[model samples]
Target: MESGMFEDEFQNDGSFLHDEFEDGENFEDTENETSDATDDPKRQGWLVQIRNLNGEVTERRMWAKQVPKLPVTEQIIVPFKGNQPVGTDIDGLLGQYLGRLASNHKLLPISFKKWPEVVKTYKDWVWEKHIKWEPIHEAAARTSFMMDMGKKWRENRIRLFHTKFDQTLSREENIRNPPLSIPPTEWAAFIDYRLEEDTTKKSKQNAANRAKLTINHTGGSKKLKRRSEEIMSQIGKPVSRGTLYIETHKRRDGSYINEEARQVCEKIAEIESQGTVPVEVAIDDSLGQVKGAEHYGRVRAI
Candidate 1:
């Protein structure tokens, strides 16, 4: 009798009772299986998130149709934005171009300390965009892409600044004098005075050395000691070099005071003329005597 009852319960081609015990179990398993299939990363599409300047975050679910197919391996080529292609030698013209952008683009410092961070940030952005770039090609791709982006950004920013703010971009001619009360023209003289002071110290030491050598220690000569005192008295007196410097300063308004120093000043002036001056600002946003950025902008009209 028990065998017959077990056979009836297990029959495959017969009627079955539908209740929570059986139906609920099957339904739960099927729902979980569907959830797992949908959650499978391989089968899922991409999602993109963008945060705007106003701090609003927007998300987009990208479907397959929305994405472009990856090009075949053989079809891949170095991306050329202008005449130059990605991964090409950048040590020449491209480097110079980036350097100019660094100089002219106020937003881009293009400094040794900051460039690596910029590159890394760009790489992360590309990754977020689902651009599957290889590790070997990442640097070239990032550099080329950044160059194109920076060039455009700088140009657009300049245009915007001019159009909206009624201000042109700052140039080398705008370089201000050093914040010291002394004029830049007088710096050459000041530096001369300091340099003469330096030479006098050396002269003092030389005088001491000479006095020691000339002293007749065995005879204990009083005249020789007086001579030593006379030599020491001349220690602070300007040397021939200082006199020559003074003459040159008078000749050309100190333009020829220190040839090397003058050359450096000229080189600095040249760079400033091109608006490539390296400026330092306190984190408090002071630019020399300019109190704040707003005041600085008013002064610079940048």
Candidate 2:
């Protein structure tokens, strides 16, 4: 009887009751297989929670039976214009937030430094835009005096007691016995003095040399002799021999043999007779002896 009952239970179905039993067993096996799949060790579960300003709680949970791996530096929350909270350091809040996110995900932080130069540049720009040009006291005084005189001339009337007019009166008073105190002239002299103060030593030397040359070349007949004496005095000391030769011959005139040229020529002939050209003649071909008619043509008529 027990064998007969086991045969009935394992029989290949020809009855509705047998078929129902087989289908139910298969469904149970499928449910067990799905439960085993959910028990995988690599699967993950995560939860996120947030509390609103009004104390409302929100929660979210997720299960991953076969989730893929994420990148090492993934960001959890992206900032949006309407949702981002204000930070204490507003100037670098975005950078700080990015750095924090990078740190949480094991990434490098972006570099940041104080830009003091930007503030300084903006300040300089503002100053240049609005600042007025202020003249010095002397310049202001001169400008005001000139402006007042211009106004008076425009009105076609003279003010006897204007400050500038009074200053002029005082100048006349000093000019009689004491020194004159003309402010305009004094201002001009002051400007000249300032200019002179800025002149270099080389410039002063050149001016003195020019004055000496000028005086040497003046006064007609005796000018050549004076120029020759001046040249000799300057040679090897104040002036080079080449410079002296050039300056002496610069104005040959072709009318008369000047004493300066005669002296230079005699010196050149003596040096050449000694079998050596003078240092001056060697430096410049023009300073060498003029040949043929050109030489005698320059000699003065006896």
Candidate 3:
């Protein structure tokens, strides 16, 4: 029966259900009370005032967890010293108050007693280790004076120092006196120098012109013949006399005729001297005469 009773107790889920119910209620209560609970600390009356030995009321705040305990008489003395008031039996009350002030003002929390020694050590170290090497106003002035003196010495040395070759006595003895009023002989020498230059320039120009003539007469002739052959080949037939003349004259070296061309040209010249009308004009004149022979004869010089 006890075993059965234990099994029944294990199966019972009421306690678990009750816990869940309680948790839901507690969550609701927490949600409703959260804002009030959060504001309670800030709204607390932490700041207070107490009378000092001088009968002046001094204000203090009890915000921090660790309150400074001091004797009432000593606390009174602190207010006289312009320190924060504290409760009796507080140790380091003044320091703690000063620490809060320093924290609030973003100042380093330095003990008044140690400040003088720290400053003294800092000044001594700076002077001995670093300041001595630094250029101060007085040192800079002295250095500038030395520099000026060095510059002046260098200038003087440059002006004074001279080798035997540079000595004025040697130079004066060797000086060629400025040509005693530039004699007429010197004018003749100047003319000779200018003549020599002009002769050299003229010779150079003549040599260049000769070289250009040789290139044009020799190399240019071959190039011109090749170009004329190309033009004739492109025309694909014997060119008319007038057309051939124009094309040959346009070439660089075609001004001079080959032997064959010279013979042909002589024959043409002989034919031209015969006083015959050219075929072009003869044909046109024949046609005109047929149309009106009397009018054509009057127009013609014949």
Candidate 4:
């Protein structure tokens, strides 16, 4: 369900605003600008395409005045408009502007197709103001700001699609349609079965490593020979350096019984009870000089 759409279209790095407007004719660093365009009607507005809270986008012409009091929230996106002063108020402006885009569809939660009904409802809402003025003001300001700039009201509807929106949609779809139900007892049994299977797999791997152990008695050193003899006496077999002898008194389930490990431990305890401590035998030095059957690629006549 992971969609690469937003990541493909919009760069998630903080430099999105910069990259988005880099190719535009009016691109400028809105962050460093000092002059306030908040009240300036002569300022040019930008026809920005932004994604809103409800995952829908439509083109809106925005000026610095429209987003002056916009709130800083995750639901909105603001494109870099050169004439607009983003300053420290970018977050809020972005949020309000996004909310405005979503407002026409979801804010009031009522549909009125007739123009008179829309006007009457708007007038009634003007008195109540439950649907905060910020979104309304932003919408009105964007329209007025665009008109003041002498730009045509083009129906050039543009949708701003980000990858994150797809994921959000997927999550909502999941909430609407969850996975099929499993009875509590069967679910618990399934979990226990999985745990047991994992434990058995690990135990088998450990058993395979233990099976690789072999007794070696090839070293010529006296100390190694003595130690090797001690281990051989205890295990009734030869012992050598790197030889593995993994014995355990208890099974993996923790039940204890006299096992190979317990017998080995008893023998070692008996050896230690005598003065000489058992040590590992070293490998034969001649083994290092032994050549393999395979030869190098070429040989010289010398």
Candidate 5:
């Protein structure tokens, strides 16, 4: 049931990473980044807020050393501070591991509804392999591991479609370079699906929708949520989304990364000057000029 539903989502939305040919700048670029925070969490210190007995509030410094850590293959990670993992991508660290687990377990056509099953399989496999993990830190269930797996599954499928499997090439030629995790049988079916007329049309439509995006992030794979939290820790107050957006899109030289960013930041500044306008409202006003979408303000799901 879930597989069929999610299969429709794929057909209607294509890879959801980007346009058919590349991991579009929309999501694949925003969400796919490697974390280099594997060193001593002490270096990051703890970005924390302290409330005193006098009802006064002050920010403080801390680290992953203060919180629990998850053993994710090679690096130790603190999983989204016990919240829904969004905006950030751990594909660099966990993508291949997820791919292998799903392939080995015959858990192809991954779906959100089946994430619990996948997590169960992961736990069982970890136990069998005797991989040590804190009982509380279940990477499969707690972090964005499953989501990254889903993205990797779709991204690699499209990559294979574009790069290795040539339309002019014979079936044997195309299937010869099947992805490491994909079986030959699955590869042949994938090729057939991509060649189907309905599939081609849907992919084109989805790509068109993605291309309509007016804003592109320059935050580069850094998780803005964590970065915002760090800023709050330093400034001792909440950072508005508008401020964060403008800050992230600017270069060290105080120049906007692109014209669109400059325009959006300008619009935000205008909105702020008028009175108090929500960040999303400011973004909608700016984005609506180019892209006709209404209320499409949430960029970073983090």
Candidate 6:
């Protein structure tokens, strides 16, 4: 289930999840800059303007009725209220976009060890290029951006180590013939780090812990946030978190991860199939609230 458990890809390495933060580093100003020249220049700081988040975009969508027959595949850009989203979450489209850049190694830090500096550099790069995404609160945006970039960076590092480290060749040979992208010195350091005694010990412990779980999910690499957005756009309606879980946690042969998962999905599905949802929470009026949502309207799996 989406909330009940995390995807195994994210939980693969303890080192990636927990890294030592570089101290006393100066962070660049991550304020959301105005893309529109018409915007008041006086208001160019931490607090940015917002919109009406009172109801769902669907209900507020004047074109919903007029465009009912539109192809489901046709992409629609729904403008959400609260221009500056509350709290700190990097799981939105903005984060996903930046995360893609991170995965591609386009978004990089000055040094892997200088965590704060990396966040600063990343913020500068994004703000300069993406004025359209200039409404998220600075703290929230930077924290999420840094984390997403860091995770992807670490994962990519490990992937490179696995794919490039040659078993047939000696360590010196491998280090000398570094990848075109990586610097010779950095590559050598990385190789040495991987072969270090403490690093190997920690990796073994993490692997042992990961092996404790018997049931790995069938869902691929897509995060639930993106998956839910796609579903909502396709159906032209919101779906419950439980329903989302049932959709994702199923096997290729139309079976569930386990018997317990089957039971939960069945129960949640039954509830969703019923028309017991209130009129106020209609697809057009309100974003269909996930059946049992918690924490800033996010849903949890049973």
Clashes of each: 3, 0, 6, 9, 6, 1
lDDT of 3 by residue, 1-302 (tens): 00000011112210000001111111101011122112255543234333334545455543222222322321211211112122221112222222232222112111212223224454333223211211222244224323332333232222222211133443233233212322334323322332356745964787788876421221221223233334456877533332333344333455543554444444544554454525233433322322234443453211
Candidate that scores best on TM-score: 5
What is candidate 4's local distance difference test score? 0.31
Between candidates 4 and 5, which one is better according to lDDT?
Answer: 5
- For model 3 the local lDDT of residue 41 reads 53
TM-score of each: 0.20, 0.17, 0.13, 0.15, 0.52, 0.52
Residue ranges of candidate 6 with Cα displaced over 4 Å: 1-100, 103-119, 126-139, 233-238, 257-302
lDDT of 4 by residue, 1-302 (tens): 00011211322211112111112112112121223223356644444444444445455555433433333221124322232312223433333333332222222211232223334454334222322222313444344333321111111100111211133444334234321332334333323432356745964787798787543222211123233344466789644222222222334354334454454444544543453433332122111112112245531100
Pairs in steric clash, model 5: 18-24, 45-62, 45-63, 46-61, 46-62, 46-63
Q: In candidate 3, which residue pairs clash?
A: 69-89, 69-90, 70-88, 70-89, 70-90, 71-89
Model 1 misplacement above 4 A: 1-123, 126-132, 166-302
Please write out the lDDT profile of model 1 over residues 1-302, one tens digit for every residue. 00000011111211110111112111101011112122355644333332333334344443322222322211112223333232211112222223223333222322212234445554354333423333444455456546654553344333322332211422222123222322444333323332356645964786688786521211111122222223235565312211221222322244443455444334434443453323332322212222224443443211
Residue 261 in model 3: shift from native, Å?
A: 99
lDDT of 6 by residue, 44-127 (tens): 222211122231112112111122222323222322222222211212333334444454333453225433545565656654
lDDT score of residue 159 within candidate 4: 16
Candidate 2, 100: how far from true, in Å? 65
| Residue-level error in angstroms, candidate 6, position 210 | 2.7
Ordered by lDDT, highest first, the candidates read 6, 5, 4, 1, 3, 2
The local distance difference test score of model 3 is: 0.29
Selected candidate, larger lDDT, 1 vs 2: 1
Count: clashes, candidate 2: 0
Query: Which is the winner by lDDT between candidate 2 and candidate 5?
Result: 5
